[model samples]
Target chain A: MKQSQLIKGVLEGCVLAIISQGETYGLMQALHHHGFPSLVGGTLYPLLAKLEKGGDIVSIKKPSPDGPARKYYMLTPQGKETFQNFQHQWSQLSGHVNQLIDEVHSNDENPGHPG
Target chain B: MTKTQATLDEINRLTEQLAPADQAYFTDLQLYLSTAGLFYDEAQLNDQLLNMLLDLREANQHGQSARAFFGNDPQTMGNHLIQQFPQPKLRDQLGLFSLLLGISWVFQILSSPQTAGGLSLNLVAFILVPILEICAIILIIRILHTSIYPNNHHQWWPYLLTGLIVTITISLIVILNSWVTVGWTFLIPDPWHTILLAAMAIGATVYLLGALLHRWRHHQA
Candidate 1:
């Protein structure tokens, strides 16, 4: 609870979801809108490598106009299915979370959750 | 802006933190981002899809684990303390061995008297320097044993540099000693000096052989 298992689940969900598409370049950029550069080397490479090795993700090389060739990691057909499964689980979990958020009422004057 | 540009922007900041030489790996990272944007969020998804495909290719190539290849763990929030750096115990062992050998060399010299003149010089060189060189070579062998093979943790190029430097340093010490004193030996006696030189030569030979053995092990791995 202290670590927020939900966050890890959400991250895996989001990462897996990205792979569901054909392929990707920088996941941080795609997911940056959610929260990205916030977790750089610490969370990025090892996760990407693991996801690739796990057989849920596949990475390849494609030439880049700006620089050298870029490695693109894409979710396989299997990865797409995984993404859907995680998505489904997340949806149900988020619904309950949303209800909880809605139930908690706070005065406009004290929104920060203080004494 | 275009999706690629927008996605590139978000990740480029994080990419900046990596070393300049590793830029290509970042491009692959960019590709990963572009793919994920297609999916919004879902309840549950299969986690092993991409990995399974990669495994097939890497299987022929012999798949390397994240911990072995990148020295990192992906399951947690940040880099695991164990994965981020080199093993400390090995370095500690090397340092301890160096200290002990240096002390032993000093003690050996202090206790042994200067037998002859040039003989003394040859004796000390044959005796003392080999201890230092032996310890250094042993340490190098230990490091390379753990550092090479199917899943080397370190970048290989730097190890080459360390080996070259260690060899030259030991050679320099020997050459300088010869220049200052009675040639190769301590001028003990005519024939004994030759024998002593031969012994010193043997010490250098053993040290060089040890280095070669280490290199061979590294290549095989």
Candidate 2:
């Protein structure tokens, strides 16, 4: 699958996780460092807008030390709940996929000895 | 002054190297976001995008050519922006009314007014004139309440009132002297004369009724 498609699937949850700590421009740097190096304002702002529109997050303007004032996003209670559910689903889905891969690997290794 | 401010200025300068279409893409995105009620300043958004462009430029220098341009389809983004506001029903209706009124008015101007008798009313004009007049009035009323033309609510009242007064006065003169002798059609030809007279009558009634209703509402208020 395309990296962008993978990122698209979980970017919302990742954003929620980052925002849970604090809202900062540092979030952009963190996203870049954490595997979304190509993620730009074009993608991020629209995602943020959709989140705000959905009532999953809210923002307020705060003075940034470096440049102009920045809009800081904070998750609502509904957003937190949604993120927790996402985490739960991710854990289960990833675990099942891992097991399936492991089983496939073992079967390949023992292909000649199959009864 | 500050290190960060200097860096931002550098970033802004570097962003100028972007193609005009790319720059416009960013500009339009900023506008859409602002109109959609995003609270962030436009400069901040521009800065973030600029930083991304710088990163791509750096990568390109190192032999990796990432498309710095934001590849999102503008139409989809426009749709998202439009979803923020309710559908503008009055504006949409006015748009359709204006089109039909325009078509009928054009037909009136083109069709010959000189028939079996000296001066004859074309049957098409006879039917279309009333509909055109009614649609025009409705459009004016809608525009007065909340202008679809200017898109500014504050200036609508003045424009509406002035338009109403002028249309009514001219319409009154035309209606009163429907049979006045004309030496020449002059600048405009024969059919245009009847068309203008009909237009005046329609415009006058529309203005008079609009003024009365407006005054009545103001008095109530």
Candidate 3:
């Protein structure tokens, strides 16, 4: 699969995981600091809106210590539920992928070890 | 320019180069960040905006278009934003359908010749027309309320209740008009009977066609 396509699938799950920690500063910041620096506001904001619409997350305006009131997004009950589901799916899928990678590495070390 | 002023200048320059629609997207993002983010200070907000511009510049240098950096074009993103909110167009179309039904019924009543002892075109219209009009108004209100508030399939209740009421009302009007226009002595006589059937058929067909179009557009989203 294309690299961007691969990142696209897991990006939302990662964003949800970040929000699951606590209310986010800005989801784009979380994504950027987490190593997905290529993502921009145009992509991130719309995803946040879509997630809010789907009831996965909700935003509330709160007074900021130094600036204008900021909208902070917290995971809704539905969001937590979806995050748990993604966690389980990712664990299972990654476990199988890891196993295949390990097999490939082992085979390279001992080329004639297995038929 | 100082570092801060230089960042602002670069942002302005890049923004000026964008197509109007893309520029609108940049404006929307600015508004959103300004209103929503827990920025430590105004400086942080500016830094974030600067970062976004720098990312765009980097993407451009790497041979990616501005839209590629954004991942989707502005129009597609705008549509996604809209789909999160229920459209007013649905209610608008409902109004149009109600108008069409009213006009067709009025035409059916006025054009038919009078018969002995049957309810006159004026009476059927006077009695049922207002009721139908009221029903249409209620239906529109219900649609607006449910869409604005968004309470699950509770939204569907207004639709179902109003739909059932409208269907029953139209049937009663058709059956009554058919009775009176044919003759008071006859229950469901010839030409008016056929006309009533035709009206019902046409109304149902038109309504279904409208609903199908709505579904198709939404599915494309």
Task: Kindly report which residue stretches of model 2 are placed more than 4 angstroms away from their true locations once superposed.
Answer: A112-115, B1-22, B28-69, B81-221
Q: What are the candidates' individual DockQ scores?
A: 0.08, 0.23, 0.17
True contacts kept of each: 0.06, 0.06, 0.42
Candidate 1 chain A least-lDDT 10 residues = A36-45
Clash count list over all predictions: 53, 0, 1
Global Cα lDDT for candidate 2: 0.58
lDDT for each residue of candidate 3 in B1-221, tens digit (9 for 90 to 100)? 34455456656777786666657657655554433312123443455565455555445566655566676554455344444543345565567656766765656555545555342454464356556655665565545433433436565665676677778778876665565443333234556656776787788799999889866875685
Instruction: List iRMS (one decimal) for every candidate.
Output: 11.4, 5.5, 5.7
Off by over 4 Å in 1: A1-6, A106-115, B1-221
Better of 2 and 3 by DockQ: 2
Ranking by TM-score: 2, 3, 1
Q: Please provide, for model 1 over B169-191, each residue's C-alpha lDDT reduced to its tens digit, 9 standing for 90 to 100.
A: 57855664454445544435657
Candidate 1 vs 2: which has more lDDT: 2
lDDT of 2 by residue, A1-115 (tens): 8888888888988988888877644455568778898775446656766777788887765665654445567889998998899899889988998999988888899997532
Question: How well does candidate 3 reproduce the true complex, by DockQ?
Answer: 0.17
Candidate 1 vs candidate 3, TM-score winner: 3
